[model samples]
Target: MKKFSYFLAVMFLFTAFAPAAMASAPEKSNKEDKELTPEQEERLEEIKSRVDEIKSMDFSSMSKAEIKDVKKELRGINKETKAMGQGVYLSVGAIIIILLILILLT
Candidate 1:
């Protein structure tokens, strides 16, 4: 009886852990891009703010290099914003389509 009770307890423990060990995480969508690290995100925000400040300045009398630098900063901000914007667009589009399908089905 002692040996049989130990076997049952060990069996219960293994069963409880087995499924979790074998289960897989769901895969991300192909439309999704790699996310930036926390540090990268903060830097990106800083870059955007700097670009906005530069744009708000009057550039009429600026030299070629100054205009070029401002343009470069603006492009960098646009690229980062576009990349971040893509994920949001995909998510909102998916939600809207799902809602439309549900409306049609009902």
Candidate 2:
């Protein structure tokens, strides 16, 4: 019957396209932080080295004002790390918003 043939065609198309859709998606990692890009790894290493260098210094010889300045510098480094990650989040957000607007307009 024509109805049976039409049903088969629809089922065949669905099965064929389903795997293609799934294949295009990337697999998510359980621990995203476990993977780091080269630049991120480099930054992490620099921060670690800076902390080690600061730890090796003799605080007894430095004046109180000098230690306060060092603490402020460490806080600044922490802020830099936070700022670096936020740019990616902001761009992704902007893209999603743009997509929603386009979808609604259509």
Candidate 3:
């Protein structure tokens, strides 16, 4: 009976600590924040601000050509953001898949 009780306590401790251990594991980079060089960070911020500016503009009052130009700039920003995310996204996806497999197997 004593041995069984000790085993139960050990199991309870293991279960409690399992999630903390997983949470503390080094996370896969899911964004370009830490990866960006100083110049790239400045450029990204500039592009983000430009995108916000475009969004806040009075599109209804703009001329057709101006709207088209803004649309082009928006598309360019989308491409740049996608490029920045490419590396981080794959790793994150892989981590998720591995976790799912572990869950299912256990």
Candidate 4:
């Protein structure tokens, strides 16, 4: 039980300091934002306008089918936006596994 408590304390300290250490590290070149092409920018602007139009619409008066169509359109837009963005996305499970690996290695 004492060893378990000590292990927990060490884990807590490690997790707390890990972010600080990472923050102090130099930023990678990939972290720099890339300039969007003219076509991409125009498409993004169109997407924004469409989203605004959807937001301003009265959903209560719309038919169920129309609402479902609108939702489908929004999902497509979400996929497009995600595809346009560049980043590494880690799921909760992956993050937990990474932390476990670090703890075990230490």
lDDT of 4 by residue, 12-103 (tens): 77667777887799987443476778898899999999999999999999999999999999999988877777334775445656877897
Instruction: Count the clashes in each prediction.
Output: 0, 0, 0, 0
lDDT of each: 0.68, 0.71, 0.73, 0.80
Candidate 2 is scored at a TM of 0.42
Instruction: Please state every model's RMSD to the true fold in angstroms.
Output: 18.7, 16.8, 12.6, 9.1
Show model 1 residue runs off by greater than 4 Å. Answer: 1-36, 83-106
Cα-based lDDT at residue 86, candidate 4: 34
What TM-score, over all chains together, does every model reach? 0.39, 0.42, 0.48, 0.56
lDDT of 1 at 8: 55
Cα lDDT tens digits for candidate 2, 1-106:
7985786577566666766776788877434355667998798789878978988989999999999998998888778766555222344335545765786699
Worst 10 residues of 3 by lDDT: 86-95
Tens digit of per-residue lDDT, candidate 3, span 17-77:
7678878899786463548777887988898788788778998998999999888888878
lDDT, residue 81, model 3: 75
Candidate 4 off by > 4 Å: 1-18, 21-32, 86-106
Residues 1-95, candidate 1: write the lDDT tens digits: 79857865775666667556546655555445667778778877787678678868988999999999878877777787676643234443355
lDDT of candidate 4 at residue 97, scale 0 to 100: 62
